[model samples]
Every structure is written in C-alpha cells, then in structure tokens.
Target chain A: MTERPDQSPLTSPRSERVRKAAALTGRSARRKQGRFRVEGPQAVRSLLTHRADLALEVFLTVRARADHPELASLAAEAGAPLREVDEQILRAMVRDSGDGGGDQGGADASPGAAVGGALVSPQGAIALATFSAEDPAAALGAVRALPADGPVTVVVLHEVRDPGNVGTMIRTADAAGADLVLLTRTSADPYSPKAVRASVGSLFHLPVLTGAEIDALLPALAAADVTAAATSGYADSDLFDTALPARLAWILGNEAHGLDEATLAAAPLTVRIPLAGHAESLNVHTAATVCLFETLRRRRLEA
Target chain B: MTERPDQSPLTSPRSERVRKAAALTGRSARRKQGRFRVEGPQAVRSLLTHRADLALEVFLTVRARADHPELASLAAEAGAPLREVDEQILRAMVRDSGDGGGDQGGADASPGAAVGGALVSPQGAIALATFSAEDPAAALGAVRALPADGPVTVVVLHEVRDPGNVGTMIRTADAAGADLVLLTRTSADPYSPKAVRASVGSLFHLPVLTGAEIDALLPALAAADVTAAATSGYADSDLFDTALPARLAWILGNEAHGLDEATLAAAPLTVRIPLAGHAESLNVHTAATVCLFETLRRRRLEA
Candidate 1:
C-alpha cells in the first residue's frame, strides 16, 4: 500500500482538468462520460473496500493522508494513483456549497462556505469512479429474484425534481431498509453532486435505479406484489391511519405539484400527512423522510 | 389605488442604487439604513395586508404591475412610489443573471450587463418596508409571556449554521405549531434572502428570536419549565423511546460537531435518532423534523 499524496495546491494543469471534470459529475454528465466524483477519506476507503472493480482515481492533500492513514493504505493496496493538490483548487472543484451561501447572522461564514471549507480542510481528497448504469428492467428483475429473506420495501420517486430531495429520499430509503429505489424521467439526477452530498455517503450504499419510464415501472411493481401508495395534500386518509402493506412501494411527488394524474391513477391508495399548523406543505425531502419512516415503523410493529 | 410602476428593467442609475441597497438588508444593516428587501407578489401582498407599522418602499416591474392589478392598487393604497424599468434592466438590477444581472439560471450574461434584448416576464412584484432593529429579548419575552393554551414547544438551534436548514426549521416550527424559534449566536440569520425563500413565506408568520447567547439561554429555559433535549450520536437513549417532557426545547447542533460539551451538559436529557442502516447521520433539517414531529406525536397522544 502506498502513502496518500499531499494535495495542497492546484499547481498541476492535469489536476485542474480533473477538478473541472468533476463538475459534470451530475447524472446526465455521468451518463455521457461514465464517471462520478467521491470525496472524503471515509468515502474513498468505502469505495476501495466495495467497488474495487470500478476504475478509481485518487486526489489527496498531505494533511488528509496524514490524518487518515487507513485511507492512504487502502488506496495503495488497491493500486489507485493518489495525487496531491492545493486546498484552494479542491475547494473550487466542489460544485454547490450545500447551504447556498446564505448569511448566518454573522456568527460564522455561510453554511455552504463552512461545509466547503470543512471538505477542503482535510488538506484535499477526492476520487473519480466508474459506475455501471443498470437497466431498469434488469434492476426490477433482480428485485423480483431476491430470496425470501430479502427486503420487501421499495421506494418510487415520481417527478420529484429537487436533487437534494432525491438524495435525501435515497438516504432515508436506505435507512428504512428499503430493497430498491426507482426514479422517473422528470425526477432529479440521483448522482448529482448536490444529491450525493445531501445523502451523506448513503448513495454509495443504496441500490438506486433511475430514468425508468413510469409505464414500464407499474407492471414490474405489480408483478412483485408491491402495493403502490401515493402521498397527497387533500387525501382524507392520513398516513398514520393507513394499513401499510407488507410489500410496499411509496410514491413521492414534486415540490409544487404532487403526483401527476397517471401515477395517482396507478396507485391503489393515496395517503396524506396530517398538517396541524399553518404551513401548507412539508418540504419535499422532509415529506419523503416522514413517509419512509412511517412505513418502517409500521412494518416493525407488524413484525 | 393608483397604478404601481414597473421596475423590471433597471436602466436608471437610481434603480441600480435600490437593488444594491436591498442586498445589504441584514438586521444590522436594516437597523442602520432602515431598509429591507421583500420579494415575490404574495409576500408583498402580505406586507400590505398586515399594514405592519413600519416605513414602506415599493420597487416593482412594469410587467409585474400589469399582471397583478391588486398589487398596483395596494402600492397606491399605501402611498408608496413605484419605479418602472425595462425587463432586461429589471433583471440586471436583480442580479439574477450575473453579479448585477437580473437573469436567474440559464443566462450567460455577466453581472451588470445592459438589458438590450432581454426577455421581460415580470409577473407582479414590489420591495417594500423598512424595519427597525427588533430587540431579541423583548420578542422572545413576549412569546414566552403569552398565556399557554397548550404545552409550549420551542425550537432552539444551537449552531445550525445552514441558512436553508435554519429557514426550514422555522417553517417547520411554524407548521408544527411551535410557540417560538430561538436561534443562538452561531445560527443562521433568520431573515437572510435564501432563508426567507426556504421558509416559503413562513418567516413573516413565525416569531423568531435570534442572537441568544447560549450561556444565557440555559437558565431561562430551566426557569420556564422547559426541558432542554440535546440530540447527539453518543447518547444511548433513543429519541422515540424517551419520556418526553410537556414543555420542551429542542437543541440541535452543527452538521459536524453536534452540540458542544457545554450545551450537552446543560441539556436535561440527551436523545438519539437510532440508525440501523449505512447512513452516518440524518441531515440536520431532517433530524429536526423527526424530533419535532416525535414531540408533536407524543403531545397529541397525551392530550
């Protein structure tokens, strides 16, 4: 295993090219170029442990290598090139600041700036990995083919457009032990850097299938005996009162517009989260978390 | 009510001055200059409806005035001056396109570019109102002094740091019927533009008290029969399993460090959101939602 390289400055033009390339790490770009960026020592280590089959490129700063010896050793053990760069360059490479650079009452820099600095602080560490895009049919087939002991819960995001929401949904679905996550065409890119950061590394662990047409998904879900439940603002039945199915697929919708007519028609039941206060609707991501957890809670009680 | 002026295209140097002034609308700046920026038609309408006792100013786009007759009438009713500008000029003034450009996403224009051929789609808008610096203690005291119809639930953000999270928390607190939101010195500004956007107009409706030094808050919470519950990874108690208090103050920490030791020590009970999957932790906003709703659920059951 080789020692992790020091990545303190953006001196190399090659490193700058790599950093610029990471901007296209969104799902659309990933589909075109077949690459994604992963950062932090823990994420890199996890990639080395599980996705060694995927081509890996490493960028690190001296501080990160020194702070995380295991990460350096793991990269060396996997025969991955660990290149070093300046912190400023690493900071520039990360796309969104997560916080949108809003003021924090002068207590500290905006959250986005803070998060960016934190990510850059470990010196600088990032990795590029190739992810095999799975066919929706093949993914559905694999879910159907799981053994009896496999996870039965499935999550469906229909027309959910926020990348942060998509990422959080995947993260929550993973936490709820859902077997699969499927996203429709109009949904946000699951692999977008924003979504990935929001997921807090859960994206790598979760089984995510994206870009599936809804018409094709309906039959596959039906074949698997997965009951579809859609969330609505006007539904009479509250989510807590519903009889959650043992094998279920939860369909979440867009922020402004809930589910479209087609998906609502496909769903066997529509559930609403009871709103007691004056706010009209929950944030899309919060709604997803609540829905996913409610399902997990129900299943646990039933078991 | 007279017709409101359209200020979409900010060609005039006077319009440029207004836009720049609005950008500096923080608590301190607002106090110093007695100005604040109000965006969107709905928010502007609400400000008028409230007839809040404060000096008001109006900046509107021609397209916005034509689209919303009521907005024009309302500005006239308030006797506020309205300025009209071309769509491009308005866009430029808003800095939507570039640093000083008004175009939002999808525009390649530099900041402060001329509005030569820009498309104008101003619906209806106005920036009105100058707010005096509110005394945080007085605002908080007023909220606390109100007669309790039911148990009080206060949200105390220790170092939330994220403007979006802070804004979302305030919105959620409003939705969940929390009595008040108390932000410590390290928390995000409650009135920042991004925060206001994320709150979805709840900022005006919810009572927010900011800059509460943590040391002073602990004693006040105790005296008010409020139990401070700290959320942390090290805590052995599950949040759902804990015996929640009738009057509670939820203290959430920064994304990384969580609640500091002093804050944790001050908290009467420490609770954790149990994670059975691969996620390291829930997003701070998501965690806040879970904690808030859990409290709501418990309170409802007891009632």
Candidate 2:
C-alpha cells in the first residue's frame, strides 16, 4: 500500500495543491476548478467505490494510511495519486475558523465547517474529485429511461440552501428508490463537502443534476410525462390523499423562504405533508423522506 | 415587554449569566445547574409557548427583540426576565469554535456550533430554563393511560450520543405521533442547546425521559402491552412485514456501535428498515423517522 515512490510525508501546510483544495470550499472556486473535495474516510472510500474515474487524488495522514490499508490499495486501483500529508495539514485542509458572520456564513460548508451548530470533526482520508461543470443532460435521459408501468420518483430542492439538508435529501431519495435528485440553481451546492457527507455518499450513487431551474427542466418533464409536485405548507392538497403519478417529482423549498411562487406555479399540484405535531413543519429532509417513502409504500401496495 | 428593570446591553461576554449560558454547552453543567439553554428564535419561542413556567430568563439582541415582539411579550407574561445583550454576547452564548477533535467531538453542539462540518449560524434569541431533573414517571403513566385499543407509541433511543440525532429523534417521534421519547442512560442529554434547537421546538411539545435503561423499561413496556421492537440491519423481520401492534416502542442504536447485544436480545422482535440504496444503513434520525412514519402509515391504513 505504501509503494508510491513519493512516500515522503507532506509537512508543508501551505502547499499549492493543498491551498487549491482548500479553495474548493467557495462556490466560485469549485465552479472555476470544476472540482470538489470529499472529506473523511467513509466519503473518500465511497468516491473510490462508485465514482473512481472522477477521483483526482487522495490525501492521507500517516496514521490513516496505517489504519486503512485497504483504502490505500483501493485508491491505487482507481489510479488516484495517493499522498501522505501531516495530520495538521489534513486538519487545516478542512478546518474553518468558527467566528463567522454576514456573507461568509454560506460560502464553504466544507468538511468540519460549523454546520447545524455542531462541529463535524474530521475523520481519516480526504479526496479531491472533479464534478460536472455544467448540468448533466444524461440525468434527464436517466429519468426518461423509467418504464411506463414502473413507479418512478424524483426529489427536487428549490432554494433549499442548507448543504446538509441537500445531502440528506439525496440519501433519502436513494434509499426510497428515487431515480434522481434535482436541485434548483439557488439550492445548496450538491458537491460541497458537507452536502456530500450528509448524503452519506448517496451523491455518487444517484444522479444529481444541479444548477438547473424549474422552467428550463419543465420541457424535459413534459416530454417524459413526469408530474412535478411542490411541497408547501399552505397547499390544500394533503400528501396522504394526493394523486402521485407513475413518474413524479417532489419539490421542497428553503428552510425559511420555502418555494418561490414561480416554482410552485410551475407545478400543477402543490401538496403538504400532514404533520400533526405542534412544530411548524418537518425538517426539509424528513419531509422529503416522508414523501419519498410514501410513494414507495403506495407503489409497493399497488404492485 | 421592556418591563424588566435590568434591561441593559450585556457587553461583557464573561458576565455570570453569559458564562452560565456558555456552560450549558456541557452536559455536566446543564445537569448540575438543572438548567438548559434553548438557542435560536424557533426553539426559544416554543419554550415560551409550552414550557413558559420553566423558562427563567431570555437573552436577545436588540434586533431580535424588535423582530419578535410576541416572543418578548410571551416571556414577560411568563414572568421570565428579558435581557438585551449585544449580538456578540448572544453569539458567544451559542457559538462553537468549530475546531474540535478527539473525545470532545460531541460535547458541544450549541446554536452556531460547527455541525456536520459547517457552522450553522444562529438565527435569533436564547433562553435559559430549568428542566425536570428526574425521569418523568408521568410519561410512562401516559402510555398506561392509553385507551384499551388506542394506538400508543414510545420511541427508545439506545445510546445514541449525538445531540443532533437525539433531538431529531425526539422531533420525529413527536411528528409521528409517538406518546413520548425515552433516552437510555448513555444517550446524549436531551436538553442540550443543540438537541433543543434541532428539535425545532418539538422538544417542548414532547415528554423526553432521560437517564433511563432499557432493562428497567422493558418490564413496564411489557406490562403496558407495548411491543418492544429494536431496529436492526441484520434482523430478518422486514419493517413492512413486521407485526406492529396498537401499542409499541421502536428502539434505535448508536451511530457507531449500534445496539449492544444485550439490548438487542431483550427486545421481543428486531425489524430492519428496507434500504434499496447502495448505502449500508440509514442515519440515526432518518432511521427513526422512517420507523415512526411507517408505523403511522400502517395504523392509518388499518383504520
């Protein structure tokens, strides 16, 4: 596993590549470089397992290398350049200074960035990978591939800015057998480290088409006869009684501002998950989960 | 709302109240003081609404007080002192450094703490309140109070240590119409600021009994005719096919170790949530949400 000729420990915390890697925290940098990072062992390993071709490189600490021999070999097979760095550099690569205010609040969400008011500490390895620079048309093609008689589900995020929420929704979509996830241009970046980790690697498992507007995607949905439904608290349509078509998309909004009128107007049906609890609503991912799993349950019974 | 005599901008971040509020980030301090903090406007509002008598004081920024006049009024009506603090003090009361490592990982997840690797910046007000120190026997008493054929559900968290997960589980249980939530002795403190915030005010709505053991609760569960079902990935019983009774309890394990063998064996049945995704298992809260909602779905279908 330690067969690499450049086996010397990378001690400099300010290496150019490491700095570039750290820059992936910003949306502009990730967009400019077409790359995002995967932090921690589980996420990095998943990248190798599912999307090895896109994995550009792997960085590990000495202790991590010793602890995870198989990960090293797996990265080797993926042809990702594996380098060992000082643990301090690895932490620096992902750490964010906690004192944040104003515009900077939403920029990074990289691994170990303060999220949901908890420090998600760094684990083992880290990986840098190239992400699709533009929306993947192939994601729509996958949606079209759904059988006429078979049940198909798609989860849509409309201005849902929390990266963790975005990731968890994707993971939930995968578990519920959704064909893909759609994130509007204003939603959290799906490739951000926090979002990727929150998805628990489901970002790689499922087709995630980001930076697309509902208006632009409407034509593709029309062609495929996919029914787009927006989830709204104000909607009169209850989830339990709503008619879910064979090919359907469930769209949720931001933690605060919810779905914009344009997005809600685009969908013929606006449905609400009937939450009996006193809390105003379910967490975005939980609401998506309820919708996704309900679709699955109904499909199973119908089948 | 401006009726409090001590209304002043708390500038010194090291003041006694600010220090005490900061100490709430630790479980020991919360336990010893019999006080826990609620951060963000949603959580603080809910505390005022549901547990107003328990609320001892509220600290808010000038802007927060101006924006949430109703909350200030509620606090005033509850006889809870309202104090204005500089935004910095408010931030300090809940902000986590986001640089964390080792065993201290789960200790502090207060509002604006680094969570899932990103600092979730705080939204608004903070509240300090005393929680019932002892496990509420009335929670179990409520389960016993259920009508002979009425649906009664209890959510059991077995050593789930993440404050976020603990809070999310409580919220899920409430949303799924569970009678109450029980935390095993080893579980995270339900009253921690992070857990309370994650609950999004559902914490105030539900009865959460902490410092409990499954062994002692099993007998009561049995006597109440509540079926104890542990969620296990290896369990042969599929969640869909499992026998969910009118009265039941769903137990979920820790994020890392999962359920200990002793706890698993004590449960009359073990059921697994079916996952079609490539991911190995569901997140603790997502798993709990799935189980709780599925039970709700089935009961509704039967009715």
Candidate 1 chain B weakest lDDT stretch, 10 residues: B100-109
Give TM-scores of chain A for all candidates: 0.80, 0.86
Tell me the tens digit of each residue's lDDT in model 1 across B1-303. Answer: 112334364565456464454443344444455555555676666556544443265556777777776776777777766665455544443343223122121111223311111122223364646542445575457445745555888888878775667778887887677877788877766654445556765666656777776787777777777788888878989876789988888888886678889889889989987775677777777788778877776777888
CA-only RMSD, every prediction: 6.6, 4.7
State the lDDT of candidate 1 residue by residue for A43-109, as single tens digits. 6766776565553667777787788777777777787767776665565555432232221111111
Off by over 4 Å in 1: A1-11, A14-20, A26-29, A76-81, A84-123, A146-151, B1-17, B25-28, B45-55, B58-93, B96-123, B130-136, B146-149
**Cα displacement (Å) at residue B234, model 1:** 1.9
Give the TM-score comparing model 1 with the true structure, all chains together. 0.82
Per-model TM values vs. the true structure: 0.82, 0.85
Error of 1 at B269 (Å): 2.2
Scored by CA lDDT, what does every candidate get?
0.64, 0.75
DockQ, all models: 0.25, 0.36
lDDT at A147, model 1: 48
